[model samples]
Target: MPSLPSAASAADMNQVEYLGLCDRTAVEWETLRNYEMFSLSPDGSFPMMKASRSKAVRLADREVMMVGGGRCFRVSLSNHPTQNKLQS
Candidate 1:
């Protein structure tokens, strides 16, 4: 797929097939509270999953593989208004 605009935020990167640390931008990933691990859907209609500081990988679709805190987890994207965070 073609590259998104220069100001592509995490929400705009839902269709991205790959994700890395370099893909994060302050305007997109950094929250007012903290730069926590999170994921959102393309249409901005889904709830945001705010996990801990973890190594994460986004699948080709709307799913994320997160590994941190001595465990690994998988999350499926959906349209809900809730914050699913892992408790430390």
Candidate 2:
């Protein structure tokens, strides 16, 4: 296993592990601002985010690698996200 000495490095490593799961669920929504949210896993294995027409649905679901509904829990976002104020 890889070693992470610094606190930041340790946190980053954990995020990678959380992302390297089997599957995740999400939805599309509209937002004024744009940002990226990677999984909080140690392995950090996820598809790179890019510019797109639709917004991403921020979700905290279970990793496909494990089973059962109560196995996992919700984690915080990569960073603090600002709410998009849309004009009608």
Candidate 3:
């Protein structure tokens, strides 16, 4: 007989897959606007924005690393836990 799958494992897998989709979307839709950067998640769940005249890197679903004007900035997606913080 085949073994049953665990609910926790399934949930974890879903999260991983979702994140991967987001990553891929970021790579696909990545663009520069007025020296700023922007991208949309594959599923259109959210949008990531980078400051103008700056470089940005997505650290996760809710985190972004940016650099510009000789300074580094850490940006967070709205409603994220670290949204209140200026830095990561």
Candidate 4:
């Protein structure tokens, strides 16, 4: 298959198989904050964690993984509007 065009080059170029996805500026991934940031009560409707200073909750060995909705607040890094970060 043909390769994608660079972010720099115009995507208007016609390709045989695949469009050149190169030359284009790469989109970045972003994180955001949730309601859990405000309330730390184990029942704030959202769970949170601090990877740098906070410790992760211990789980049972060989136990099934916990499945539920979770949330957190993180400082927004990029110009994105949705991304955010929880300040400790």
Candidate 5:
């Protein structure tokens, strides 16, 4: 499996390939490696946001609604989260 790309290296990847890499990595870590054992919140009751100046609200369906950089998006609290449709 290809290693996760660094910020500089990731610039060479197109959006689709980058997102694909992220999906594969998540599957490897969550399903194959069982890395969730190291998670601070396994149930995802408290989701973390790394985005600067972002606001997040936990939804009823175990998804987080984030607003940052003039964009709003939802992220799933699941092992194999699906990618959101990209807006042009």
Candidate 6:
């Protein structure tokens, strides 16, 4: 079995992958909102912007695994007030 990445490494990888995805999709990273949906591949080679509605309950139950820069991350969507975090 593979070991999970440390929190710092995971965050770093997430930032890098997020930036790459933004560039590929012509999205401004600084302008991304919490509600935006991105369809990321397991290898993070092809990232597509997904259309999301305003249904918080439905969105909260979805989880995605994104891999990039030789790192893998489990991203969970949540509608809980405390779970919302601004990633910078």
- Cα lDDT listed for each candidate: 0.36, 0.31, 0.40, 0.28, 0.31, 0.34
Per-residue lDDT tens digits of candidate 2, residues 1-88? 9887676665566543221232253322222123333332333333322123342333433222321111112223333233442231
Off by over 4 Å in 6: 1-18, 21-37, 54-88
Best model number under lDDT: 3
* Residue-pair clashes, model 3: 0
Residues 21-43, model 1: lDDT tens digits: 31122233323122233335332
Expressed as tens digits, the lDDT of each residue in 1-88 for candidate 5 is: 9999666686776773212111211222222221121112433333333322343333233444444333111224344435463433
lDDT of 2: 0.31
What are the per-residue Cα lDDT tens digits for candidate 4 across 1-88? 9998666565856653211112122211122222211112323322232222223221223222232434332221233233233331
Model 6 lDDT per residue over 1-88, tens place: 9998676765566542122222233333233344554333343343332233222112334444332222222233444433224532
Give the Cα error of residue 11 in candidate 4, in Å.
Answer: 26
Residue 67, candidate 1: alpha-carbon lDDT: 44
Could you tell me the C-alpha RMSD of candidate 2 in Å? 14.9
Least lDDT summed over 10 consecutive residues: which range in candidate 2?
Answer: 66-75
lDDT for residue 30 in candidate 3, whole number 0-100: 31
lDDT of 1 at 38: 38
Clashing residue pairs found in predicted model 1: none
Lowest lDDT block of 10, candidate 5? 17-26
Which residue runs of candidate 5 sit more than 4 Å off their true CA positions? 1-39, 52-88
Alpha carbon lDDT at 32, candidate 4: 25
lDDT winner, 3 or 4? 3
Q: Where does candidate 1 have its weakest 10-residue lDDT segment?
A: 17-26
Deviation from native of the Cα of residue 6 in model 5, angstroms: 37
For model 2, the superposed segments whose C-alpha errors exceed 4 Å read 1-24, 29-33, 38-44, 52-88
| Cα TM-score per model | 0.21, 0.19, 0.23, 0.15, 0.17, 0.19
Comparing 3 and 6 on TM-score, the stronger one: 3
